[model samples]
Target chain A: MGLLLTEDEKMLQESAAGFFADKAPVSQIRALRDDRDATGYSKELWLEMSEMGFTGVLVDAENGGFDMGFMAAGLIAEQMGKNLSASPFLSSSVLAATALKMAGDKQAAKLLPEIVSGKMVMALAVDEGGKHNPDAIQMTASPSGNGFKLNGKKSMVVDGHMADQIIVVAQTDDGLTLFVVPTDAKGLDTERTIMVDSRNAARMVFEDVEVTGEQVLGEVGKGADILNTVLNAGRAVLAAEMLGAASQVFQTTNDYLKERKQFGKIIGEFQALQHRMAHLYCELELARTSVLTALTALDKNPKSAGPFVSMAKAKLGSVAKLAALESVQLHGGMGMTDELDIGLYLKRIRVAQELLGDADYHIAQITK
Target chain B: MSDLEQFRAETCAWLGANCPEEMRTPMKRETDGCWGGRNWVFQSEAQKLWLERMAAKGWTAPSWPKQYGGAGLSRAEDKILKQEMKRINARPPLLSFGIWMLGPALLKFGTEAQKMRFLPEICRGEIRWCQGYSEPNAGSDLASLATKCEDKGDHFLVNGSKVWTSYADEADWIFCLVRTDNTGKKHHGISFILFDMETEGVSTKPIKLISGRSPFCETFFENVKVPKENLVGERDKGWTIAKYLLTHEREMIGDSGNLKPVAQMVAELGIIPDAALQAKITELTIDEWAFSQTMSRMLAEAKAGASLGAKSSMLKYYGTELNKRRYEVMMDAAGYDGLEWESERSNDGELARLWLRTKGNSIEGGTSEIQLNIIAKHILELPGT
Candidate 1:
């Protein structure tokens, strides 16, 4: 019932923070982007992360995971966000692992260990349009002999470019169903789309991509529950990351305010800027609690965590947007330049805000 | 079962048996809840009975020491009691400044004699207290307050006026800040003292606000006598105590965010507002959720021994501002009806009056600007100009 992390959770958070700071600071993003890295993230770094058991934060012990929970996973995600670290931890670890565990089919049980070990990368392709509307998915999974034939296009599929397998959401005769399809499956086309944040995604078009009944993540039409569970988990974890990013941006801006002088005094001395920072600090505190509560709720009971997840996502989305905008505005000229890490944060926050669900989307979800 | 669980069961059963059915419903008006005093009259017998029964069990001031007529419950137990009370939608037995503001100060700074005299009465809701801190000359710059208190051998003669003394005319006593000396810093000469509002020279004039209500008053004390034992804490060191009491005040004000959500209020009115207004209400609802969680986290952290010093300012600022916004949306939802003033059907324009009252929320305790300044300078460590 408490929002503050337990002692063990705090220790995990601190260690994760240290790991991200040392191994994958924001400079890592700059390097990968400059090098035009094929994977858009480092595999070796992800392997090390797996060794640290971050990749297994949500997987069960039977599947060779830490079996910690969403709170642990969120803590790791938050650190990754602080460092602007690029990885498929969200796609392969949180999203796919949650979907698989919830499905608990033979294929899921077989793939769970691989995901936990970082030996297999999986991506959940849920969005079929420019905007995120999971329920409006029009991709068809028609009947085929002992299997289904998929026909659809999914845009903005996270880690889709490098995934060993892709969990595709398509409409069946009953309703929406999720299919675990290999990237190399026939009639599947994957085109890497490098987002402004320098993260990896793909425009995926599936034409007559056949998959057996065993490949279905859950029962046909019953996939809505599993899909929602995966989406909510992603939303809550993304909120935690956004919280960390917003906090770091605030710290950086506050530092600049102290160091930068105007009218013969530090700009932080100006009441105008100071009040704005104070207001943002208040918002960040609220967002922090929202994110923490959401993650805790998800760990405690995923079914009832919907409203909490929406609150966290919406609150953090708006707050992070403010933080990014304020960081740029406060930094003045340097903020506009890509040379400073502030712009990188701005781009990444924008991308994350749009991912899973944006403020408006989540607000609609909550109000409806 | 654990001790707390057993205590909770007993408490729930006791409340169900003792709390009157009339008292289980929300207070229809501010006075519907008992604010006990020498001259006070109860609105209903249930109100009086509710106060008496709760006070008899020393549950009115649950966390205070048992010797001081409190139940002496642990924080966990007290929380459970509050939860149980809230579960039944039971109205608070008593609401008084004596319990909220003055009792804490007395417990911390009062001598055993002072504690013995005031604490029991406070716990029993026998005395209603008003604050005498702000003056017309001192609003946010409260240290410059110029209430005179001259020592006259065995007693002190007080002569001064306090503005924004809420419910001063109805209060039985006052916890006042008077200037005992004027030689040192403005903050240094102040002394905290208590006196009966029924003293010959003490008088209060109600001050009408925009809401057309006079919850506040201008309280005057002209050459009033007070015993030397009336003063709490060291002479000329009332500033520290004043600051400490203000933290509690801010926390109390910030907890106002715990009110029913705006959307639910709107829904109760049977008005599904336009899309734009609905969006505003939704945003407010989400913010309220976040703010509630933050309040819980802050309280838990404070209980865990974290200093909530300047952080209280952050809460006060956001909570009050959020409350103001909540009312604005509420008024917007009410539309033309919100403009109704002094009408019987509108409950004497309760919504409009409350909306206007929320405007003072950001102004009272400390102005939102003052809170921001404190947060910026203390919490954020921004440089002073």
Candidate 2:
């Protein structure tokens, strides 16, 4: 596979770009943040996204999905990032759908259509602490009647408060296990955690919540492999999103450099600023290739995609951070005001950098 | 198999049968590879044989037209040949400025007589060429070169000197930028010309680098007469050619980012890196991978007929930075042994010396700062003061 997008992929990317720009621009996120919308993202936009066939990008044709693959999904993610559109695309469509598809059981088969129809939302509750350390899960799952009882706290559960169901990672006698528990189940509590980026996430506390045998995803103790597949897919697509956001930030900053005048000349005329922008451009280019390589590997060669995914996440994390900081600094005093979109991007990029796996986390993984 | 696959299979078979065992090994040193010239000596009989075999098939200059001593392979075919050769770990048959720098300019702007005369020898590796673009005062500001070329009724009288002319003392010929008129912008009134290094009043002196090696020289000419036919392209319009050649030069330097990875070097040296050192190596490894992908994407796009233009500056800047960081990590991984100077165990302090030499990577082929400026002004279209 090549680094460039094919004709069909480009067309898909263009359509996604047009849809997001026309329907849910950055102003949508601003409105959500100002109103403190209980759902965090617009339900109408999510339905439109499903209608656009974005939610089922990875599902098979038998399940009524586009079956277009992860590259197509990544292109849509990138457009969403550029527009700063809020949705459960990552949490439900990419992460939950991939987990279900990989599980390939009766439960997954039943849930796939619900996700595609936008009738149900799902969240992958992996992280237990402040940072992403999936292997260090302290949650426990014990036998309860014919099923299992889960007792643990899952932090940073993307769209957990809004999800109809949550995929919980808990420790079992065999090892790590995955259980799909309904959000309305007894003794399960989900508290919405409003993030600075104005995105939705929740802290879920499960106290003796019971799940049936059918709720278990894949074989018990073999959940690590499935979880890894799900996480890597998420990391690769998230990296694409970050790349798009960083590119837009750079473009906006560059345009401002040409128009904003200081000391009787455009600030862009300054060699210092020019050099910084140029370096950021180089970094964005490198990060773009990293993201594309990882997504292509995921679509074409899934078995060997671990290191590529880590590299893309790490590279894009650092580059997107730089892009945000430079945008703020180059925009001068106006950048600090809430009225400008630069601050919004800075906050969002900060959240994205720490979301699945930060640069340091991924770098450690690469060396390991 | 399709036509390209058929070509690949044939090419693979041909390389397997033709490339010698000794020639399949990597060069131990830069000088171990053949760079054919009038006064050159072969490092080994295998080197001579490989050059002859490849040149005979006109594969030495794979994509050039057959009339100019090449196989006239399409870009795809040439890429396949390279991939096949790399599969065998084969060394390049010949390495010369004549092939990389001068040949492309000649192909684009040379007259019929010039092409017929110079292109064949370049393909056959009969002459080694050195670039004579930079003078003492005209490095980054090459357009301000004062290397005067006086017009005469029968010939051109050239004076002044060029510094940092790589391998000038060993080269048989020089493609130089000469000042033909002093009236217009500094970029104007320049002429690109070629002349024999052994001409009367021509001389060179090797300049030693921090690596304790002398791969570059200062070349001087005092009233050296060049034939009228030696000029390439229009007089006073050589800046365009100079700019074009610089792009190729930048690309060549950027390609140096493909150096053997630092982690592999540490592994070969049998060093077990600690946690911190391992992290540094891993970071470098990832950066290297990202840089390589960028390089390949740029090349593929260029092959698809997209103009690289200012993007080459980005490649040159990032590639050199990545290479420099790789060496730094290498030195850290090497520890005290990396400080070795003048020792056989260290290959005469090869790693240390090469590490020191990487200092020039960001400085040469237009400094990284200059590349940034070009990217800003051209690619980003940043305004000027």
Candidate 3:
């Protein structure tokens, strides 16, 4: 995502782009519209992605990962967004893997290989029902049998129902803590919910779900630090994905304007529309710069990644929202139909704009 | 050692030895800038020493060929020289419109004799130049300029006025666009010519701006005769040269948007209490940083000789917009205290005047609207209506 990419990064981007283009194209996503699958993605395609080592993109080499940095992960995310690929790349590979890595030895040694081999799926349960506050862990983690018992609810958990294990952010007597509770653990319940974007999420209710001492990630009550690190990386990758979606949709709309005629000429001939498209390109390019900067900054120092990551998310969120609106408006009636790919981008972007904190949330975060 | 690093070390040594302490301080006002011309005098002995030392080493115009009184450093080395200069906070030795605008045109389009005659003086800061492109009647529609020049065999007799000529009264020479054969399209028959500001029938009237001081003038050229040798390129074909020169001009204006980070201002202002203002500053800081990174990338691209083409218009619009936003924030940060005028405590209301001056940044190098139109037409390849 830097101005100049290394040959390895370039190759990764190209191969990932090609793979998504062939395997998880928009048509493949559209097929999931009526799919009864609980995961909201293709298992075969996810397996193919794991074969490509995408699942281990952020994990350490000792844990069977490529040991590539956040920028490399961003490259994959961008490509997936371009294809409108429905997968757990973010929920599992990016968010959960980052959490485990930041959680350090004990947790990663046990769970990461299973994730790398595509045998396990992990979902991070951080945001509660209210606003997107990374530190607002209302879920209680009480001491129980030398471990902890979690009791609360997590809403809009991406790929939560399909998660083999969930990293739950909850408050303890000391402060915030993370407990990696098995989805099948007693007193835990997950209800599948279909989002407006046609992806499946879960509202997880934890009724005194007990976790062992070994299940507590990192130092107890230090989950806030771990959550911040994971989410910053997550938000940056999310911004990259949103950029790819916005860029592709912008390109699609521009091409449509050139071809679609109104009155007596191609719609793109209108100076009014041309200016609008030009402005959109500017926003998109600047947003791209923000993404690259966030990725690069996070790679260097995770602690300082908050502001840069928030900038990228806020800027790209606004840009992607603009792209969605303009793409729909520019495409006219066709954009409203589900058959068209433009609406799909709009739906996905509308969802992405909210995930990992929306523009307004991040603007407030950095502003505060 | 890599060639550039070695050159960088040598440049650092030379600049350390030459750049005066007085020159190393941040330029606090417009007068601190060394705009070299006939009327220009060194404000201090240190200023004179610094310029003389740099110009002697042919570094005033680093990348210009050695024959043109330049160091003839490669682009990479030229960048290193800039880095070295900034490392020590070195003020630019010579600032001239001649070096930035007309010199490139002359090197590319002028006769060999013209290059030999004019470039050295420009590089050495002996002759300062002001542009004479925009007339009172032609602004955004610049090609419609009707500044007529009559062909008189031995000379071209010009009779017209140029508006918004920055520092024209103090500039030594003017590179002007004159109407030579306005018999065809509006753009046709335009000739680019050069002449001294002290020529007969030449005069300038300063135009007062909202900034309280006049840096621009209305330059009048009535029956001023310029030698046939002073004409750049071919007569009636100067429009090409004019367009080429505008690219450089736009680029210069676009770069003006790279202001220092707002954190420095916040530091100067002490603790800011308003959360909204703090947020705005943070956002602006990030944007400024990103914009600078974009500029660096563009510069690298330019060094590789890849034409930015109409993308310069994009840069121009964004850069000016950024500059305007910067001043707006600074004024806001100053609160009501920034509204003072001609007071020593407020440094003659410098910040307030600067905020007003930024209004012209967008308008001068083609308005933001015009740049957007250019981007839409050329960069976006949208059909013209």
Q: Give me the overall lDDT of model 1.
A: 0.92
**lDDT minimum window of 10 residues, candidate 2 chain B:** B299-308
- Residue A144 of model 3: what lDDT? 95
Looking at candidate 2, what is the lDDT of residue B337? 90
Better of 1 and 3 by DockQ: 1
Over B1-385, each residue of candidate 3 has an lDDT whose tens digit, in order, gives 9877778778898888889999999889878988776677889998888888888898988888889888888777877888888888888888889888998899889898999998998877788998898899999999999998998888889999999998898888999998998889988899999999999999999999999889999999889989999999988999999988888888889885325677687568665748778778777776676676666666655647454778777777888888899889988888877898878988999889989999999999688888888987887777777
lDDT of 2: 0.91
DockQ of each: 0.85, 0.90, 0.58
**Quality of candidate 2's docking, in CAPRI categories?**
high
> Which residue pairs of candidate 3 clash?
none
Per-residue alpha-carbon lDDT of model 1 for B1-385, expressed as tens digits? 9999899999999999999999998766665668898887888888889899999999999988999989888888988999999999988888978888888888888999999999999988989999999999999999999999999999999998999999998999999999999999898989999999988899999999998899999999999999999999998899888988898898889885448889888998889888889889999998888898898888888864334899999889999999999999999999998889878989989989889999999999999999999999998999998
TM-score for candidate 1 = 0.98
Tens-place lDDT digits, model 3, residues A1-368: 36667789899999999999999998887888866555689999989999999999998988888878899999999998898999998999999999999887677888998788888999999888755777666899999989888999998888997888898899999998888888999999899888887787889999989888888898887888888889998899989999899999998988898798889998898877887888887777778788888998999999988888998898888889999999999899999997799988988998888998998788778776
Q: How many backbone clashes does candidate 2 have?
A: 0
Show model 3 residue runs off by greater than 4 Å.
A34-37, A104-106, B256-258, B271-273
Q: Order the candidates by lDDT, highest first — what do you get?
A: 1, 2, 3
Best-to-worst ranking by DockQ: 2, 1, 3
**Local error of candidate 3 at residue A134 (angstroms):** 1.4
lDDT of 2 at A259: 98
